[model samples]
Target: MNGNVEVVVVGGGYGGVTAANRLARRDGVSVTLVNPRPEFVSRIRLHQLVTGSDDAVEGFGEVLGGDVRLVVDTATRIDAAGRRVSLAGGGTLSYDYLVYAVGSGAADPGVPGVPGAAEFAHWVSDFEGAGRLRSALDTASASASVTVVGSGPTGLETAAELAEAGREVTLVCGRVLGPSLHARVRRPVARRLAELGVTVLEGAGARVTEVTRDAVQLDDGRSLPSAVTVWTAGFRVPDLAARSGLRTDADGRLLTDTTPTSVDDERIVAAGDAAVMPDHPFRMSCQAAVQLGPAAADTIRRRIAGKTPAPVRMFFAGQSLSLGRNEGVTQFSYPNDKVNALSISGRTGAGVKEIACRFTLNKLVSGARKASSRGSHGDSGNRLETPQPEHPTTPHGTRRSA
Candidate 1:
């Protein structure tokens, strides 16, 4: 490439910020990050935002690289054939390469027979929804009942946080609590929730069939009074890739080969919850997003140098769940994400969880500093070093070429 290589990173979450910083390290590479909000959202602490424990947002100046152009607007469409991205704020950006990292949000409440859920239940998956729920809680009476639907980590964290804050909380697990956790680890989590005075509802009978303004109807002919309903179930990604005629999985995540290059176009790569690497198929967690972001950026850098890009490598350490401000659990796992027997709980676990959150922010800040320092010397060979797990293991599968 004779001139500057333009790269547009869509979304400013963990993935986008990291990718922008990494790409900006190389000379003659221009990085532009397009995000709806000017501030960076720490999504891992969203549950804390609901309870007024943390703000869950940071100034973009703290995380994003100085050399990266920040576009405070939404990306409406991607014209892949023309190498252009249409913005909702009225304009188009021509890119030599694009990185798709639009994160995820709560799944819509439109179950088969579950009516009124979309209108009645509140969620805390995104920043806007979290703010709305916090306001609703402020005005509600102290005696109002709060019901959290879903047994996933989000549900567990939300229920525990609210219960610890003196709210009459009920966790309605449609089936079992911590479905993905090993049975041994789930035992301690259940004990902590019980200590916090949360009403845990399990079994088929606990499944919520309908959500109303005042109560929720269960599958087993039971009606529970719920003044504030918080839905924290599954997550759904943006439809940007699918709408743009790019190859996507059924869930609308951009379908990429092992190199994380879109099968539809080699110049378009993806990361975070918005991308699906067919061979790896990792879960949508910050653990994966932080690593995949740099991997995607590395692919673009390699292509710019006329070299073959290496396949993406991802490793998971474990699941970190904060029960509340004081208590939490760290369920360690293998690189493949299968829960192992080792675990930590109580206050020690809380410390570990807090460190993980801070580590993400620190990682971005440090990466930006390194990139900025290297850019000053006019050297493109200096690579941004991303931290790896202590015990790394190879993901089982052959690479899928784009």
Candidate 2:
């Protein structure tokens, strides 16, 4: 602990980026963020990417710290024993503290035909998948039926986006539409989707039994004609942590206690959708990722200063589900994330959703730039602005704002 603390953050998503910037605020802590992509992806807008409403990318400067090292590379393996991370491209980097935040991806439901049908289905999980989905929509015939499997927020938003654009869309809900919402609030969501011209298929026959290129077969022997099938069911995390010999949960997320430190190794910590906080077990969402990121950084910072870290507590306002540009739904929830049943819909809901998305970006950028004000102007709080000219570079390029 005498020398500089070498902290390597894996994954450049919201959690990792937030941690890197916050950690860079303190001196004697070397922060390096390794990610597969050079640009920061706005995951909240990835669905917009599919609908051609957003590009969902920015130069690292907009979201990463001025003093943090940015390594554009994929982590192949983690050697926890030696504190070394092997890169897919080659070579390895050592760290005194490792922050695991690789995030999650589209899950395979182990259906009979899911794996083979994946090639024909569209996904909104990542940047590459979103781009592919956009291209698919372009080539799909104007009157072709677009079936969106699942009724989660992403599925709902995508179906609404396509329907609003005049595309024939169907939302195949395995159970019920907006299952997370209370029965009272879910009624309005159904009415809104119906108003938007989305076919909400629920009940016993709605569960997907098979996926084909041109249609999705349900358990009730009904086959919905789908020119472009989109699967947005469940998600699974990367297996890097499990393969690295770290103690992880069933889904490969690192198992951590209140401190967010790996049960097997005190030097390793985790955050984001990929993390399963044993104490709180928060759901995988950007809301949790933002907080978890800084918490992980604060833990490392505190541990280096010979102090114990505090457990993470997250706050929730509501769930924002965009029906389209003009219609949406916002379900109020307590700080514990329990639905309070208070709701908003139509344009007002859409406005709230838009503000949340924009505010999320502002918070990320502001958090990253907070390190620049360290000690110089007596500024210590997390406040963000566009990057300044004096911001230092790491290796080559990977910085930008706006």
Return the TM-score for each candidate structure.
0.92, 0.92
Q: List the residue pairs that clash in candidate 2.
A: 61-399, 61-400, 62-400, 366-384
Model 2: per-residue Cα lDDT at residue 301: 91
**Per-residue accuracy of model 2 over 1-402 as CA lDDT, tens digit each:** 698888989998989988888998998888888888778899888888887777889777767766677776788888988888887756577899999989887765453355435667778888887788889889988898999988888888888888988899999998788778877778878988888899999988888877777888888989889999888887878889888888788778889887788888889888798878776788788888988999999999999998999887788877998888787889999998888779998899999999999998998889877865553443322222221224322234433333
Candidate 1 accuracy as TM-score: 0.92
Tens-digit lDDT track of model 1 for 1-402: 679899989999998888889998899998878888868899999999999999999877668766676766688899999998877756677799999999999888774447989989999999999999999999999889999999798999999999999999999998899887888899989999999999999977988889999899998999999999999888989889988999888888999999889999999998799989877899898998999899999999999999999998788999999999998999999988988988999999999999999998899889877666745544222222111223111112222111
Show where candidate 1 strays beyond 4 Å.
111-113, 375-402
Candidate 2 wrong stretches, greater than 4 Å: 109-115, 375-402
RMSD of 2: 4.8
Candidate 2 structure, TM-score to reference = 0.92
| Ten-residue region with minimum lDDT total, candidate 2 | 380-389
lDDT of 2 at 30: 80
